[model samples]
Target: MKQTVQLAGLSCQNCVKHTTAAFSKLEGVESVTIDLDQQLAQVTTDTAYQVQDYQEVLGPLPYKVESVL
Candidate 1:
């Protein structure tokens, strides 16, 4: 499964690193890539992951998930 999570408040590579780390820790997550130009995180997973599941992992960050596309 693949998802593009639109994020707000991200302005640097550290944000990408943080987002990648968080999502990578989720169960069945295979990969995470952030596109700073689009303010989106492209995630690849092995399980049926839901939108809220992504939010849950990112909840503690300063960045906010705008949507899942």
Candidate 2:
């Protein structure tokens, strides 16, 4: 499955890198692409995962998952 996650607090390439790394670490996530300009992430996963699950993984970070679709 593929998910497009709207994010907040993303301002630079470093933020993109961190967000990519965070999502990429998820067990079922196959890949992560972060767009700093849009402040969003495109995540591809092999298993079913919910918005809350994504949010939880980013809980420790400064960034927040605004929405997921």
Q: What is the C-alpha RMSD of each candidate to the true structure, in Å?
A: 1.3, 1.1
Looking at candidate 1, the ten consecutive residues that score lowest on lDDT are 46-55
| TM-scores, all models, native as reference | 0.87, 0.88
For residues 1-69, could you state the per-residue lDDT of candidate 1 as single tens digits? 888888888899998899899989998889899998789888888776667787799877988887887
Q: What residue pairs are clashing in model 2?
A: none
List runs of model 1 lying over 4 Å from the truth: none
- What lDDT tens digits, residue by residue, belong to model 2 across residues 1-69? 888998999888888887788888899899998888898788999876677887788768898888888
Error of 2 at 63 (Å): 0.5
